[model samples]
Target: MILSGMATPTRRSVLALGLLGCALPGQAEEPIRILTEEYPPFNYTDKGKITGLGTEVVQAVLKEINLDAPFQSLPWARAYETAQSTENVLLYSLNRSKEREKLFKWVGQITPTDFYLFSLKSRNLHINSLEDAKSQNLQIGTVNQDIGEQFLASQGFAVGRNLQSSAKYELNYEKLKLGRVDLWVMNELGAYYMSRQAGDDPAVVLQKALRIPELSGGGNHMAFGLKTSDAVVERFRKGLETIKKNGVYDALQRKWL
Candidate 1:
């Protein structure tokens, strides 16, 4: 089911009073620091601005909860680490994996998505199974701490061996073409979106060599650092539910995907 992840305040005006009503009566509410990276149409930098479907949804959720958070984009690895190390932080479009279940407080899901091992169309690589890809000993480009990286690691793809990790998503895209990495794993939508961002047609530049079902279920979410109060997490969760019920969620999905 569609759920949560977050936004930039410059583009989104905070609502004076959300469903949480925390904006009223001179109450002091702790501000949340929302973080994400370049993984579109989930979230990405667009014309020097952080935006995408996830950004919009999180912005809407902030409005519902009477909360204001600054949306910041960092390299995937740094953002992941910051969210883990800092308190009162919200990270999104996060893949809700079993490996990460206890690391953070999950607010809710954002949207359903598929992950794939992608190869340049020109290479004509064939990977029918994870083992097939592993047997090839081909270098796979990935973003550090991304779900794609973590899943491949679980499958025995080790860094500096078969996995070549970069801090930025677009770097992996470049590595695929430069022949530095034989393949890259990313969300299906991001494959197309990133290709377009680089001014190439995904149909012409890339092909899905294998689909990783392990990365499919509960792929995107908004999660707070473990130290974040349960009360805050519940507030955001309720806010996400509010948007979904009010038809705001569907409108955003249609706009971005």
Candidate 2:
């Protein structure tokens, strides 16, 4: 005869047993793969080492949990795709948006940045708003798979028509300088960084044509794969909160932003 409640485990106990089974020895946890791109002053390679504000913040968060994982800089598109498909993958400096909210488990915000449409100062182009810019039918240059491109696409801008997409932000800047594109869409800080890399003064070369404040205000975040467990996500989230409370977060921001 089968025993009833006397022999059968309760639902809570069964769940606890399952969780314990997952934690047993020989059930190793997967190492996290951190992915980033060459968005300088945030995440970039300096002499073969990935070090920047975002990278440091991620490293600090991981360190708090005694986890050490080096960031790998890949093309933004490739890195984005990898993070989408791979488990235990973390992507940083990713702009948070309503469109992307359900796709990944978010860790925390890393940096604040503003996006703008910039034209060469010499052109004296003036655009008061997105509609004004759109009316002009200007060719806007943006990096492929970038937040700028995503924003423009949401606004009904089509690539190969009015939007020129490049594999890199540097290439987009080059296209703007060469008159291949009428406006360059990028973050304000990134535009400045690219200008400095090209040995040009940002003030002298670029003028902000239109500011997209809605896209700018959300800042960027460290995102984990959708399959990542809540416990893992909370560990990083708590670590980030700890850093903010202890003042490491603000110090990094002051140094980078």
Candidate 3:
């Protein structure tokens, strides 16, 4: 009874139509762009590939959802801006702060770190607390836009006056070595790593400096752009939970720490 201009549907056509109807709706059409800065033991470029604890954890989470996203290492400020402006963007090893609480959709905590004020042993600097350091009126070296810098700024340390901000952590280390800055503010682990990278024995450097604990911002986290869909964020959150339950998260931490 089909018209000459109309094609007749067969059993095969009916089955094909049924299969198309079963396809999942609202599937993500694009891969997420993960961003990070060169913070060693967390996320950094090694042998032209992004590899680190945070990177590994993120990869595992994405794998659970059958998604693979490549990490792009950019300057901290640039990465922060890009994640703020772009949808489907992810950033990790990000410190959770009151000022940054509502800026992004947080996924889960990654790792814990302690910030400290390090001064050369030669200076014999004695600082038991933040108030003691402030009394000294020392020039503190910090990476631009880093959490340490933010914390100091919140404490009334002004840039170009008592705070010397550098775009690279290595530059801050250099400033510390040159005595351009009296105290270098950095993460405990990061200070050791940067000391090693600067061709100094990390243990020796640690022995030579005083590590006065300054800021302990609970922990770092993986976060997505605020505009990203809740569904996508949930997928990542579930994946993170799955990995943690399966002991993969602890394994990654052991490997790095």
Candidate 4:
């Protein structure tokens, strides 16, 4: 069937599981290795267990397809490098961009994320526009956050200082307290997740968003990444469509968020 001229997937019509690496003779029923970064509310560790909206959703998706996979969390930069450099590995909640479209075999959109600029509420700074904060010394905290990093670098904004993977959020929060940074950039959902994880209040709140051509054109799409291969990409595309059609996608969102 057609959904706005796009093919839709249902649980009943999986269309020959044999071709989906399911019953392939040489393939083993082992776990697919996935590289991930801690992006709070999306992917993070709690009590030594990896858990987050994106993490859980990806897990559920793999489970439904009987695809065994284990997620390993690392620095965002390192995780992305590993996905591209390693074999049979996937990265999740990755931003979609033209530069990266051809980089990996893509799959499952975990969610639509909103990019925002955050600052201390007491900073008394009103960022009605991206250019408004140009004159100020803004230190945006992002842990190899793809879009955020690219956007700032492209615009020639001062990156201030690089933050550690696990400490980006909390470091930014503390930076504001010490008058070390002016503003921090983060995803709306991500900041919230990190706030709870750090057990600290976000003195800096989302002030505005950085408007870039890529993000505006495509919006924000968070998906999984795998090695570039037609079969792997097709398999994941089909699985994602099935989940969306079966209400599993929406249900998971409501359950988690």
Residue-level lDDT for 225 in candidate 1: 82
lDDT digits (tens) for residues 1-257 of candidate 1? 12222344422446534534564432327667899987878888878989888889999998877767789998878888888898888999898888999999999887778889999999899988988888979899988888888989998999899999898788899999999999999888888888998999999999899888888866589998888888888988999999999999889888877
lDDT of 2 at 225: 77
What are the Cα lDDT values of the candidates?
0.86, 0.86, 0.81, 0.64
Taking the tens digit of each residue's C-alpha lDDT, what string does model 2 give over 140-205? 998778888888899989888889998878898999999999999888998899899899999999
Per-residue lDDT of model 3, residues 156-183, tens digit only? 8889988999887878878887989988
Clashes of each: 3, 0, 0, 1
Which regions of candidate 3 fall more than 4 Å away from where they truly are?
1-27, 207-214
Better of 3 and 4 by lDDT: 3
Q: What TM-score goes with each of the models?
A: 0.87, 0.87, 0.84, 0.76
TM-score of 4: 0.76
Q: How well does candidate 2 score on lDDT at residue 2?
A: 55
lDDT digits (tens) for residues 68-95 of candidate 4? 6677888777777877876667788787
Task: In model 4, state the lDDT of residue 108.
Answer: 49
**Runs off by more than 4 Å, candidate 1:** 1-28
